[model samples]
Target: MSDPWLMPDGKTKVDPFVEECRLDEIPFPVWFAPYTKGERLGDMLWTGGSGLKIASQRMIDALQDAKITGYRTFDVDVRDHAGNPIKGYVGFATDPGPTTDIQNILGQDGQNFVFIANQRVVEALRAHGADELDIRPYDPSEFD
Candidate 1:
């Protein structure tokens, strides 16, 4: 993750913008930049350690239904390079995992702010067919 994340639009580059944010806060909608091509939004987005989490509208609903915490979400206005409204998406800012292996929440860790999801989060994503992420064991030393 040395280089910035190249978005699906092939135009937007998401760089690490925030080192951290309060769990109760919902930062401004994260786009980094607009997309030129008509690439659809993924259920889960690349955060680039921005501390802001972007998710599809459906994903948001799923999370809400699960009643998870440590984050807040808000509406996001996504648009094409031409400014056409891209709907059904939102952004959230969440708490860090405290450099531990969590088993019941959604959080980030380390330099890359890699997503560290608990089993419940994984199940929610899996149930919604939004499992486009890699599941890995947490190695505390990585962040040292």
Candidate 2:
């Protein structure tokens, strides 16, 4: 099964992802669906929907230890494929602080947003392994 809000006919019944959400619009302590696939490894992870920044506890600790800013963390509850509780994870959000003027990056999935991670974030993501982000430079002018 896909996300709960996904219909069998390939449509979504609810707004997908927390990307454009305002602070008050989202419920604190985000809840994730059962993770039934993959090794569930990586300090940073991607879910099918609900695009909150899911980071492992080690990543969170590293971020805090480095005094990273412009983001907030929320508690999250996740269960493995077998309904086993998966601990040591949290959801986070950033405020787009201190960005350069080379603006408006695009996501590989045009419908979603992709962001650049700095050295601090890269270091944090290395808790398990290298960040496996799909980077595709998009220049929207080609569509014109």
Q: Number of clashing residue pairs in every model? A: 0, 0
**Against the true structure, what is each candidate's TM-score?**
0.57, 0.56
lDDT of 2: 0.53
Q: Over all chains combined, what TM-score does candidate 2 have?
A: 0.56
Candidate 2's residue-wise lDDT over 1-144, tens digit each? 566444344564434434543334443433565333667466556656555556677766766776666556766666665656678877655544455211223422212334555655555545534455454445468545
Q: Which candidate is the best by TM-score?
A: 1
Query: Clashing pairs in model 1?
Result: none
lDDT of 1: 0.53
**How does residue 39 of candidate 2 score in lDDT?**
76
lDDT of 1 by residue, 1-144 (tens): 433344445564444333343222323343432322436557756544354556677776776777655455655555555656667766655544444223223322422325555677767767877755677776777767
Candidate 2: 10-residue stretch with minimal lDDT: 101-110
